[model samples]
Target chain A: MANIKIIQGDFQQRLKLQFAPGIKAGFPSPADDYSHETLDFNRDLILNPEATFYGKVEGDSMIEAGICDGDIAVIDRSIEPRDGDVVVGYINDEFTIKYLDLRHRKDGYIELRPANNDFKPIRIREDDDFEVWGVVVWTIKNWRKY
Target chain B: MYGIIDCDNCYVSCERVFRPDLKDKPVVVLSNNDGCVVARSNEAKKMGIKAGTPYFQLAEQFPNQKIAVFSSNYELYGELTGRVVEIIRQEAPAYFRYSIDECFVCFDGFADTNLKEWGENLHKRILRSVGMPVSIGIAPTKTLAKMASHFAKKYEGYRHCCMIDTDEKRIKALKLYPIGEVWGIGRRYAARLEALGVKTAFDLANHNETWVKATFNNIVIERTWRELNGIDCVPNEEMAKKKSICTSRSFNGMITDLDGLRTHVSNHAARCAEKLRQQGTVATIVGVFLNTNAFREDLPQRCSFQETLLTNPSNSTITIVKAANEVLQKLYRQGYHYKKAGVIVMGIGPDSPYQPDLFDFNAEQFEKMKRLDAVVDRINKVNGTASIVLGSQQYTRKNGKGKADVVARSARRDACQSKNAIKQDFKSKNPTTRWSDIITLK
Candidate 1:
């Protein structure tokens, strides 16, 4: 029995410390029945872990839409892009963040509308090699500026 | 029923995820050290780009063709494939990853379900979520499911999902499948089977058990025959116990000294030990292999491998690294330029409650080693990989551009890197894993 030891599931082991949650501290609190896990961005906010990707915003492409440079965009490829949705599109060998404007579908071409007035709208003639790479689900901004 | 989902052209497909422009283009990914083509896209396959074609020969053979080339980036491949596996984890009733690109699922209770539609929808979901195209195969046994996946990849009519549910379908699939391609029937057995006038899976399945037993007395071949005849004989334990862990790398350049070779072997040995501990296993043997580049015909060529048995099977990095260095000392030749080297840990089994020899059992030291290893594993996980590597594992590395952020702690840190850092000149960005390399949206 010299070589006996614990094995398997070594990663999920936790410290055997005791603050004693079961000690009935302060009358067990009134909200004990409804206690649950806290909200985590990785688990709750991101619905599709497989399809989620992140991109850093640049060039003030969507500045008027409150999506500024240095912000992080959470893109979900599994989501369907709809009219007035902020989406990432690949064009001219780069990813451009823009609003998907499908209101002109009867005119035989859709447009990638920009949020800032300084930038012009990019239109497709229905013959171009183009696709909306992913839809923007959320954007995180750093207000404190580290 | 059993289902196998295999990533189509796995490494090349991983490379194409970030670069959507590479779609419909001829692309191939090279092995470590930019050695040779290990993966080829369908378009590249159509252009007759064979796997294992050396890097230099690609330009010579296809003079005027436009083909995309990539160095194998396992970080990207592993991350992307992990996403695919995550989707499978959500969709499949029960599954286990067979390899990096293949996953086996047991559809035990879904008797009334439409497996074909289920497989098709699974494929669609994976492709949609991960941008990875996978082929699905469903059958009564694992072997037949693997064979069906091949048909799903070959013919478009299967819609990336093939099922061998009926006897007629199984018989037809067996007839069309070549003998050499059958699972568990390796090359040696395939040659023996072909010599006996058995050329297809159907040929082996059609023979009676007495003939199979009389012809080949091997149990593995017999199991293949039985599985081909619709018997489920493959065990999950065979998949669970990896049996061996091999870590090898072709150097960026050849090495002529024993010291440099020792560093490479120690790194590989340490890697093998880490892998063993991660899987909660221990290895009873430590093997080392050294070889010269066969392509350099002008120079002398030599290749050899030798292993040493341990007094006690161990997964400790120091123990394995020391054993590997001892073997390397015997295997090394003074004047040969070694191009590649590797360490293999075999005879692997569960680490808990191992038997110890009466003469070599040291209980106190074993406890110390376990505590040390656990702390090292934790430190490496938090600070980043290889942060507290063994002294023997330390080697000065070439500063490949864009990777100049080596921690500055000592004079050794500032010293130039070892000459044999792997040559991955065409490795793409790790946009998915690294924050500094994430995609830029304009």
Candidate 2:
């Protein structure tokens, strides 16, 4: 027998969208039987609220990665970043978002590979005063702005 | 055993959360109204920037230095520190926040756990999750734990967590610790102790209980002596909670009129009530204090404080504000330039289970006020703060239109800025709290 487990998200936070405040408390409504909680973005999306932060992308360095300018990136600082993960790093006294390349760690350095061809990958030496600020979890796109 | 985790240079570290580039650089956070330096980074301290140095004196004291100065941005600090507290809530088996930057973790059930490793891992978790570095100290007593935290911060060899478990280790640490630096020992007591040749913590701890009582005749000093000797005597501060909550700040400038004083006092009282509601407590005594600038030697100076008792212990903003304003009326004096005003609420207790006064307790009205407060708090929380504030809480700042409007940080940036315009010119961006102020990644 094969034991397979599918991820099931159980959102414990329920928002009663069908009801309004100041309704008379006597005689429960028949609508109560069909009441279902509305979806909550905070509960469903943010796995770790304490470690979450938002940063706005400024340029096309990550355009090829579907992370573009004017997009909002959700970063999680608590996660231990891994190879090939889109991470936010502090380089040249500015925050840079790129794919972390750990393939060259055996040679005493790693690279932050940019998605677009116009930008060069940032090479960080073993002794560089650098750290992965956070791992990019989600990038929000504004489809139509009024 | 008890462990104390304290944030290193709390305000400076909070400012550095958004400005990652400022790490390992000279940074200082000024107090309210940018009056004086309240917190300094390690680099700034190395550059001889002393605490309480006025904002105007920084350039004069250290000429041509690249020092980053920031006005106190408590909104950013509160949000970042809340995240740290959330992390601590998950990591420690049992913990209580002592202050905005300090938390105490109790190891009552875990006898076999490695306390030092636990502290180190907790520090690492908080540092990564919140970007706020903390030093952990573990000892049998809270006082000793606080001292251990100091050693952990001073010496890199300790690796941000120092534990004093053995008697020999405790004795050695106390011998090296200064008496003035001991927790619960105020500056006056430290000075008096120094005069008696008690320079080191070991000297005070070495004295018998009889000598400590005979010389000092103080319970706090005796408790400090016992804590230094590794006996858990000092009570847990968080369990007791804050005895009194005072919401006070110096005016943007000198205010001479009673109307000006009324406006400021109302805001402070409202803030105190909001804080009380948040803490799920009520205050019975509401007090107001006003003072003239002590530095202005040319002008007449007067300072007065008056308090009034409430008919019923309450956390209602209107009730507290009304009581505070009545006290302010009695304390205000003519012909004095007032520099600061504050509202303090004392005799706090749990909001529920209070014996309401038999004469004034109105159940219907009390319930109405509670519901009203709940709605107001919800509205403010959803729509930024001060959206539904009392009219009296509005500052008497006249805009170009000469019409009164609510002055709050979330509502209008410039309107609130006009209060401390010059001093807050160097205030940093509140990236964590505001959406538009989030960092830009290039």
Question: lDDT by residue for model 1 over A94-128, one digit each (tens)?
Answer: 88899999998899899998889999999987888
DockQ of each: 0.59, 0.67
Cα error, residue B380 of model 2, in Å, equals 2.2
User: In angstroms, how far off is B133's CA in candidate 1?
Assistant: 0.7
Candidate 2 Cα outliers beyond 4 Å, as residue runs: A1-41, A144-146, B237-240, B399-414, B417-423
- Model 1 lDDT vs. the true structure? 0.88
Error of 2 at B242 (Å): 0.2
Instruction: List, residue by residue over B1-442, the lDDT tens digit for candidate 2.
Output: 9988999999999888778889999999998888889999999999999999988899999999999999998888888889888887787777888888898888889764899998899899999988999999999999999999999999999999999999999999999999999998999999999999999999999989999999999999999999988888766654547779999888878988787788778889988999999889999999999999999999999999999999999999999999999999899888999999999999998999999988889999999999999999998877767777776665555453222444443324443645533257678887777888898988
* lDDT accuracy of residue A77 in candidate 1: 90
Residue B170's lDDT within candidate 2 is 98
- Across residues B1-442, which tens digit of lDDT does each residue of candidate 1 receive? 9999999999999988888889899999999879899999999999999999999999999999998999999889988999998898888888888888999998988664999999999898888778899999999999999999999999999999999999999999999999999988899989988999999999999999999999888898889889999999998778756889999988887899786788789989999999999889999999999999998998999999999999999999999999999999999888888999999999999998898988998989888998998899998766656778776776644542222333434314433344566667799988888898889999
